[model samples]
Target: MTTPPFAPVTDADLAVLSEQLGRPVRGVVGVAARCVCGNPTVVATSPRLPDGSPFPTFYYLTHPAATAAMSVLEADHVMRELSDELASDEEVAAQYARAHEAYLRDRAGFGDVEEIAGISAGGMPTRVKCLHALAGHALAAGPGVNPIGDRALAMSTWSPERCACAQPGGAG
Candidate 1:
């Protein structure tokens, strides 16, 4: 399995993340994906946070524009369409299952959290849910790894190739 590419987190990155999230980030292992402007788009968080909380959503989407676009897609009920596609298409289901395994493998690199041992974010391997998490995985894992995430990114108005970050050049 190909491990996802991520850069080591810096204090500057943490500040930018705090600004983007409107709160300080906890247990962020690395910057999973970046915007065209070099701002963090997705963050690879630890399975367990500093507060002893078991956080299962490892690939957390932090870019405001990307997150907003995903929220719009969810509001439009695009999830149902994707869910139907998953239900009807055998290839999609297979790909989604693989995506789930990939997610588990990626998270296992960090310490294991028993509370979320087998769980992956976004209702993976079964149903479509939370485009944000799926898109995060897509951005971090790169194209062709997560079909549903790729589809969600394709459908969304946001594009990683273009800079939509509020803070240009990842200014904190």
Candidate 2:
């Protein structure tokens, strides 16, 4: 049986994402370009939050094939490179604990513990989980504060149709 091909994000979808971000997307560029493997990467920069401050934020969306390839490549890279260091069960548990704690603390400003637990406990969907893992690796390799792997960015996807960032209405 043939597996259905993944759908690519279209220019119209990119335009929608740019619109939701409230800025003219600067086209595929830089780290966004790297993550998308040269696929068209849409970027909206310095988006403001009503009251202006240097938002210092960007939104990146890639073609679906590139997105999928990135996921696989990142996973393979981690497995081959970090497997020895992460081999022990104790080490794996410790890493999970650290990552989970970081996730909780980073999200704590939002509200109650129960709500936060509920949200995270729901289990991230497969694609999102992979992207989040990849983002973590990307950040660890970078300099400075390395904010790229945070839950907000990690949870984003190239599927503009399903992306809240690409669509209007409701706070995500």
List where candidate 1 sits over 4 angstroms from the true fold.
1-3, 168-172
lDDT by residue (tens digit), candidate 2, 37-115? 2223333222233344322223233333334534654555533333333344454435444544443333333233342
The residue-by-residue lDDT of candidate 1 on 21-61, one tens digit each, is 99999999999999877888999999999999999999999
Going through the candidates in the order shown, the clash numbers are 0, 0
For each candidate in turn, the TM-score is 0.95, 0.31
lDDT values, one for every candidate: 0.91, 0.35
Error of 2 at 167 (Å): 18
**Among these predicted structures, which one has the highest TM-score?**
1
Evaluated at residue 59, the lDDT of candidate 1 is 98
